[model samples]
Target chain A: MSSHADVERRLGELLRTHEEQVISRWTQSADAPRDELTELYRAILRAIEEGGRDLADLRGLLAELSRSRARAGYSPAETSKAVFGLKGALYEIVVAHADDEVLRGFIRFARLIDDLGLFTFEAYAEAREKIIMDQAEQLLELSTPVVKLWEGIVAVPLIGTLDSARTQVVMEKLLETLVETGAEHAVIDITGVPAVDTQVAQHLLKTVFAARLMGAECVISGIRPQIAHTIVTLGIEFGDIVTKSSLADALAHAFRRSGVQVSGGPATRVTVRAEQA
Target chain B: MERVPILKLGDLLIVSIQVDLDDQTVLALKEDLAEVVVARGARGVIIDISAVEIVDSFTGRMLATIAEMCRMLDAHAVVVGMRPAVAITLVELGLSLGGVRTALNLEKGVALLDHVRGAVP
Candidate 1:
């Protein structure tokens, strides 16, 4: 263990002595940007000077480098390569001196670089996971949008799979829009929804029930033939909640319920007559 | 004991619950509301809960019970101004408050009661 300490001390001395050469060589071989590589090199020197095995500063710098690279669209292998490049840079300098003790120290230094490279890989993976989580949240926000269809009427056009979290967002948004607009009617259009299982049906019923509890009636629209079939087969009863086959039909129903009369003008009637002829 | 005020507006008794309801307050409100409905011979009762922010299952049950009691006394009850969070929590707790009529605000609640009275007559 003492010899191991001795070798580590020798490596630190050699690193301090050949600082400029080591940094320049590392910059050329590493995949990282030049300015960041220089900053990291300085941190490494500071860690070595502190004279303990704790490379906390160096690890911090490396983690930051890997995270930024991950965000910049670099692959994990490329990110770790930035750390491993130091091994090749130090190997060249150690070979030039060609002493037995220095060579052992070089091996220990190479092992340290390997550990850092693995750490860089771990950091890169963590960054990618965080990016995925953020995108999922954004998708949830984007998928459920409550828009006013008419006076005293609002619509929530639901897209994608109806998970518990996404459904909660949709329900809250729909109910809030109902209160904000004083809309007595809400139409939940599910044309973009891919499938409707029992769970999705349950969520839909809950949303409608919640809206009803707020004194607003909900009209579920965009029920495709397949979904209608599935609903019947699954024995899921929507029980007194109005559902329409299309969004237009749902809006028409909402307008009718809100006592709004929608009649087309003579110009549109002439156009329809021309098309029929 | 804090009491929820019951205001008389023509044939409608408007009970606006403005405070965070505890068990005793809810029980008092129920009893007082029932008494007022009978004494005033009210045609409808509108319960406004827009100021109420939090509700557990007990409060949810009380609202339903109050509405049912008003119905038995031959007075229609409309719960109005229920916030989105409270509604969601009630639904999560599996209390749909099925027989209770709901309106967006007090004005709408009055309009709804007027409509119900018109339709029934």
Candidate 2:
């Protein structure tokens, strides 16, 4: 049975001599590639050496390792094992040199390395959350595309919930697109929006009013039966803004405003603006 | 007194605000506009606020106040030519000019008022 003093004295030599063996023990079934494992082990040893009392020195290294693993599509279990496996390697050293003191030393080592493993997990979760949030924002931007259907008509087909942030993006993008396209008519289609409440109605109103202030006449289309019913039940007056049953209807209304008519048959007719009574 | 000019064209009052307005100027314009509307028997007021770059909370309230006054005096009020940035700012500030009608430009505003007038009686 080796004493605590004996274990401490032999720690440096034990690590240097049995480094490869310990690494081999830890990397048994871990999915971390061999090259990454080698670099990671080197970093972990340096951190434990430089940070004798605490794992503060390893914060940056662990954070980067966890984030990289997360980005590389490693599962949480795989990422966690990547750190926990190092603990196994460190334990092997304790088992070789120390006797009765081995248990005490192993306990302290486990506490420190376990904390570091937890840090890696936290970092992995944070990086994954950031990736998810960024992807969601990109999807929102992509879905809210402003399509110029005709010379003077631009349409925005809104999908998903109209949260405050999304509404701001929608309004800004629609206004900028309206200016860029020089479209006098804007069709805001809400077919993809699942529901309409007061807040959603307010967002739509704000967007329509902003477009109206920009010299473009806005017509809201894709007013599904349920959405219309919701609006009426809520007493949310969409007031003078033209509401249509579908995008085609809105487009028809826009064409009519520009003095053009759309018919179901192939034959179409253009009405002069002079017919306005 | 730096008052926003109010030009009476027939029964319509056209207010083209071409200068940056201080609080005092805005207040004076309000009083002057109300008096002119009453005196000239104006049926509609088209306020062109295109030149004013920013409509902070105070300016936005002033607009709402002017529109409310027009309503009380039986005159229709239309705010025209509000810049895109200004509109965005107003919406962000959460000050919706609920009582005021808006148009893209002065011409459209006047046309809107005429349409309203024709529809009313």
Top candidate when judged by lDDT against the true structure: 1
Q: What is the DockQ of candidate 2?
A: 0.39
Steric clashes per prediction:
0, 0
User: Can you write out model 2's per-residue Cα lDDT over A95-165, one digit (the tens) per residue?
Assistant: 66776655665665577678878888888788878989999988877877888999878999998888878
**Poorest stretch of ten by lDDT in candidate 1 chain A:** A265-274
**Per-residue lDDT of A1-277 in model 1, one digit per residue for the tens?**
3476676677778888898898888888875677898787767666655654678878888889887887798888988887888888888889898887789877766776788899999888787788899999999888888898788988898888888999999999899988999999999999999999999999999999999999999999999999999999999999999999999889878887878887874244433445555
CAPRI classification of candidate 2: acceptable
Number of residue pairs clashing in candidate 2, backbone atoms closer than 3 angstroms, sequence gap of 3 or more or interchain: 0
RMSD of 2: 6.3
Q: TM per model?
A: 0.89, 0.72
Question: What is each candidate's fraction of native interface contacts (fnat)?
Answer: 0.83, 0.40
- Against the native complex, each candidate's DockQ, computed on alpha carbons, is 0.91, 0.39
lDDT of 1: 0.89
lDDT for A166 in candidate 1 is 93
Question: Model 2 over residues B1-121: C-alpha lDDT tens digits?
Answer: 6777899898999999988878888899899999999999999999999898877788889999999999899999998887778888887788767778887678778888998999996
